[model samples]
Target: MQQIEFQLEHEFVELNQLLKLVGLCDSGGAGKALVATGEVCVDGTQELRKTAKIRAGQRVRMGDVEIQVGSST
Candidate 1:
C-alpha cells in the first residue's frame, strides 16, 4: 500500500479539507461530493459525513489514496 503522511494545521481537519490537503479532491465541492457519496473511509469504515471531524493520528482513505493525519508541530 502507498502511504502518504500529512499534518493537520489545527487539532482536527474536516473531511473535505483533508481530501484537498492530501490531493485527493481537486476542491472543497468535489470533496463534499465524494464524502456525500460514501466514498471516504476512516480507519476502514465508510464515512458519509462531509464535515466529519477528523483528529490527529487518524487515517483517511478515499479511492486509492491513504493519508495519515498528524499535527504540524
Candidate 2:
C-alpha cells in the first residue's frame, strides 16, 4: 500500500477535500462519489460521510492508498 502523510494547516479537513488535496481523486465530486460508494475508510472503518471532519492523526484509506493526516509543523 502507498502511504502518504498529509500536513494539515488547520485543525481539520473535510473528507472530500482531503481526497482532492492528496490527489486521490481528480475532483471533489469524484471524491464524494468514492465515499458514497463505500470506497473510502476512516481509521479502518468504511466512511460514507463525504463531509466527515478529518483531523490530524487520522488515517484515511482508499483502495491501495493510505493517507496519514498530520500537523503542518
Candidate 3:
C-alpha cells in the first residue's frame, strides 16, 4: 500500500478536498464521485460522506493509497 502524510492547516479538512490536495483526484468534485462509489475508507471502515470532516491522526484509505492526517504545528 502507498502511504502519504498530510498536514492540516486548520481544525479539519473535508474528505473530498483532502483527496484533491493529495493528488488522488483532479478536483473536489471528482473526489466526491470517487467517494460516492464506496471505494474510500476511514480508519479501516467504508466512508461514503464526500465531505466528512477529517482531522489530525485519522487515516483515510482508497485502493492502494493511505493518507495519514497530522495537525499543523
Candidate 4:
C-alpha cells in the first residue's frame, strides 16, 4: 500500500479537499464523486461523506493509497 502524510493546517479538513490536497484527484468536486462511489475509507471503515471533517491522527484509505493525517504543529 502507498502511504501519504498530510499535516493539517487547521483543526480539520474536509474529506474531498483532503483528497485533492494530496493529489488523489484533480479537484474537490472530483473527490466528492470518488467518495460517492464508496471507495473511500476512514479508519478502516467505509466513509461516504464527501465533506466529512477529517482530523489529525486519522487514517484515510482508497485502493492502494493510504493517507495519514497529522497535526501541523
Candidate 5:
C-alpha cells in the first residue's frame, strides 16, 4: 500500500480534492467518479460522498493508495 500524509491547510478538505492531492487520480472528476462508484473508504468504511468533509486525523483509502490526513502545524 502507498501511504501519503496530507497536511490540511484548513479544517477540512473535500473528498475528491483529497484524492487528487494524494495522487490517487489524474483529476478531480476522476476522483468523483471513483467515489460515486464506491471505490473509496474513510476510516475503514466505504465512503460515497464526492465532496465529503474530510478533517484531520482521517484516513482515506483507494485501492493500493492510502492517504492519512493530519493537521497543519
Candidate 6:
C-alpha cells in the first residue's frame, strides 16, 4: 500500500482527531468507532485508543491506507 504523510501545525494531535483532520472519517464519533474496533494502526501496531496522542514522525494505518506525520517540505 502507498503511504501518505500529513503535516501538523501542533505539537501533538489526537489519533481520532487526525483521522478527521486528514479527511479519513466523517466525524470524531466515526473516527472513534473505527479506532475502537481496532481498525486503526499506529506505527504499524493496532491502536485501540480513540484519543491516542500522536506526534510528528509517527505512522498511522487504517487497513490499506497508511499515513505518516511529517513536514511537507
Cα lDDT, model 4, residue 49: 91
Model 1 TM-score?
Answer: 0.89
Report RMSD for candidate 5. Answer: 0.9
For TM-score, candidate 3 versus 5, the one ahead is: 3
Cα-based TM-score, every candidate:
0.89, 0.95, 0.98, 0.98, 0.93, 0.90
Question: Candidate order by TM-score, highest to lowest?
Answer: 4, 3, 2, 5, 6, 1
In candidate 6, which residue pairs clash?
Answer: none
Which scores greater on lDDT, model 1 or model 4?
4
Q: Write the per-residue lDDT of candidate 1 for residues 1-73, one digit (tens) a residue.
A: 6689988778788889888878877998998999998878999999998989999888998777888888887
Q: Candidate 6: where are CA atoms >4 Å away?
A: 71-73
Residue 3 alpha-carbon offset, candidate 2, angstroms:
0.5
Candidate 5 versus the native: TM-score?
0.93
- Sequence-dependent TM-score of model 3: 0.98
Model 2 agreement with the true structure over 29-65: per-residue lDDT tens digits: 9889989999899999999999999999999999999
- Model 5: residue 7 alpha-carbon error in angstroms: 0.4
Cα displacement (angstroms), candidate 3, residue 30, comes to 0.1
lDDT of 1 at 41: 96
RMSD of each: 1.1, 0.8, 0.5, 0.4, 0.9, 1.7
- Off-target runs (Cα >4 Å) in candidate 1 are none
lDDT of model 1 at position 52:
90
Instruction: Estimate, for each residue in 1-36, the C-alpha lDDT of model 5 and write its tens digit.
Output: 989999999999999989888877899999899999
Stretches of model 2 off by over 4 angstroms after superposition: none
| Span of 10 residues, lowest total lDDT, candidate 3 | 64-73
lDDT of 3 by residue, 7-58 (tens): 9999999999999999999999999999999999999999999999999999
**C-alpha RMSD (angstroms) for model 6:** 1.7
